[model samples]
Target: MIEQFLTSYFVKNGEHLEVPPKYISDTIKQYTVAKQTARTYRNVSFLKVGQLTKTKPSQELINYKFTKNAKRKLTEDFSTIQSWIKEGWIIEEIVFAQDGRTAKAIHYRIGPSLKYYFDAQNEQQTQRLENYVLQLQKSADIQPIKELLQAVQQLNEFVAMPIEKLAHTTKLTPHWSIEKRLRFLHFSIGFFQLANEGVLFDFKEIGATLFDKIGGSKAFDRDQKEFIEELERVFSVQTIDCGLISLGKITPVFFTGELMGHLAIIDKVLFMH
Candidate 1:
């Protein structure tokens, strides 16, 4: 009964409800059991709000009545409410009443995971949620990510080959600058990662940029074809339609720890040159 009332309240308001015990006591006094229970508990477990409808609460009257036992049941459910607080579903705090500091109310402020309570609602509520998420994303720290990438690049397990060694091994042209070699290696790693993830490739755009100094579309097609052929020969990658098709041979190995370590090495080799 409490859950139904709260759901309705949150959906209608899309804001925190100052629900006192008396409010619950009064609300549940309106309806009978079996029928209301059958209507409200439609296979949804209590507080599993995600499975429920993504609609705002209606102004329609709720018609459930609470018996004496039902009232007792509500009181005994404080432990469940406390558990919600621990799980961060609800934020609880005390605030002084307008009249005096002695008179306090336990304010159930909505937490960051407030989306779970209500679904698709008014533009105002949706905008509020979007703004909140944007603020959080804007405040997010990226230094740790850079540090982790740097660490991956430094680790020997992920360092397949140093730039000089790689150039020598591949027999890259003598005229190729270290910067150009690095760029080529990075592109190879990116191509492999994309293919392994079964992503589609846009050969025209990619080839135009990478092979721009060499020639036009035809040269790009030739170079990318060679690149794809080498990948198929070495990594056993499967592709069709001149490498534009999704490749899948590496997908299964992509998540394995050893393969991931090698991928990190590829990332290192990509940048080191």
Candidate 2:
């Protein structure tokens, strides 16, 4: 329950707040009471931030004893919660009374360092990318891609093709079938993965290359625009002008996950072959 409270607090605020020790206990009590009163009352807000004071806490809170085990659990839960924050994850500052004999309140805020938190996020993002690839494979038409990869591997005459020529030569019909579109996306994914690895220059280059793949400037304007739009939406892709006198230059803003090493699984045509 304490962990949930802390997690939600971080998610909602994405900042630090000074919380009273008694307030935490009270909040937990409210949560327990809410659960008991109504099963539907599952989520309770814990956004309250208390001001620190040099004076002693009120008698009611002082009389309210927080268990030693509970404190330990809260500490452990906070350590776990800190793993989720990317920025100043959490800073705990103890405010002591003027007498210097007793602690007053603990100040919580975004801190400066949390290396392990980002490491955890990277692992999760990588896993998400892997899962996305696996899911994409289930629906994407990839048999032709596999065969094309094999053929390319066996051929020595075929050097890597230039982006402009490929776009100029290949022409998309007025309409694209769903199967054909998915097949095209399969290749786009390969290009994106390659770009992620720094093998390709960037998203703009990938865009221009892909723009040509879909039939270049000669293709119908509506179809080309729609295809490019979908690519941008799915992969955080963007297009740029390389002064090629056309939409031959492109760039990508971001790729979701790291799948460069696992090319065979993500996109076999470019990486596997």
Candidate 3:
């Protein structure tokens, strides 16, 4: 579901998925599915209308692939050439520059092979199908994953707010990488869990940062208290004895916790150079 969540995050409210079909393929591989479902597709569908007229004269010579994937070898489907011939005549087997670089590809024009592939009977339907791919590319994205990590760093730099305050002040978007952000949120959740038990205030009787004083400076209202109660149920964390806790786990022990969370969060998303 993380993959679906990430894919939907990019698409926003669109019907078609993004282009570079490989991204979708890669994302799908992350989830549980039959291996064949992920691996069983023609690598690339390179479509180009061949310019030379002497061969087919009336036919358009094009690669068997309607989509081009740079990583896929043009050779894997060379056997498919026979399959193509089953439906259409092979005008030529040649190597030509695709995107202006020399690459081996089979080019054939409109014929029985392509007829079923792209129904000539319905021209408008074919055009819409092409437009759909173009729109899909604009939909799914990877930038937000990067953006979230940067945003969290900025928030931590300034102030230490409660969970609700943090969410109110910062934007945390969910996607496949959402678990990355959730890890950061979870670290604070442990502290709030401690606070609910009054362990923070109890330890502070000796000495501690002001933030751990819960109802001290940034006090918790009834609604916020209810939130932590829910968070407890959601994460299913248990309360531990404050006497058994380390000083670093309690402060305003939050700075150390936040720091740890941030470092762990960075690793989960894009790796830091």
Candidate 4:
């Protein structure tokens, strides 16, 4: 039945059937026989007649020998093989080849049949399966941009405060010594220098024109202390010098605080170090 089905379905078309090319060659050898006989010529010259005959094998003739052999080697192997073939777990195709001395031979293309089974399956089903797998892979890949975006939004809101009111509300505390103030100012300047370009600073030269407006380090320290105190009072935030000032949270209005001015803290010394 299988051979008949293959013959009818694959052989009718001029195009070779989808069988293994080797199978086609083997089939041609198995089913074709050549007979040679002496023939008499009219001129009394001897001639040899070579006749090639083609025959179709019966279902029993084409029965799979491996099935029986496999069953003998391992019990139930034949049944398993039959089941796989019937369920489209194996597939076969017809192929053709030309010979220099004789007519072309027919071969079969054979392989595991799952591909043929799916050949008849719905395209949309296949696409859905592929898309599902892709989605699974995409989900497995992680991203960190969301948290960064949220942080940026929060920071933007904090830097939107009005400057004048912020400065007025801030006041220096006794705990904030001049030395601490000077250090904070120095650190702030450094942070700004790293964050931006075109900034002028002269930390080594005391008499440099850079500090002329602020009257050098002493005046700069005093101003910074007052400014920070006023900034804290107006923004309702505490300033800690853990290398970088950490104002836990601030409203957008606090950005415009009088002493702090409009500033966005990007990469701080704390994070960089």
Task: For candidate 4, write residues 1-273 as lDDT tens digits.
Answer: 333334433333332222222222322211112222264211111111111222332233234322211221223355453443334333322122232233333222222233333344446555654454343333222222442333223222323323222223223344554334333333333323222232333332222222445555343343444555644453343434212232223324333434633545566522211
Cα lDDT of model 1 by residue, 168-266, tens digit: 644444565544444344344444333333446654534343344645333334356555555445334454522455322223323334322222356
Q: Please, what is the TM-score per model?
A: 0.23, 0.20, 0.20, 0.18
The residue ranges of model 3 lying beyond 4 angstroms of the native Cα positions read 1-71, 74-177, 200-273
Question: For model 2, what is the C-alpha lDDT against the true structure?
Answer: 0.36
Sort the candidates on TM-score, descending order. 1, 3, 2, 4
lDDT of each: 0.36, 0.36, 0.32, 0.32
Error of 4 at 246 (Å): 23
lDDT of 2 by residue, 108-176 (tens): 442222222334555786575455445445433323333244322322111122322322322332255
Collision pairs in model 2: 88-111, 203-250, 203-251, 203-252, 204-250, 204-251, 204-252, 205-250
In Å, residue 270's CA in model 4 sits off its true spot by 34
> Which 10-residue window of candidate 2 scores lowest in summed lDDT?
27-36
Task: Tell me model 1's lDDT, rounded to 2 decimals.
Answer: 0.36
- Candidate 1 Cα outliers beyond 4 Å, as residue runs: 1-160, 170-183, 205-222, 241-243, 246-273
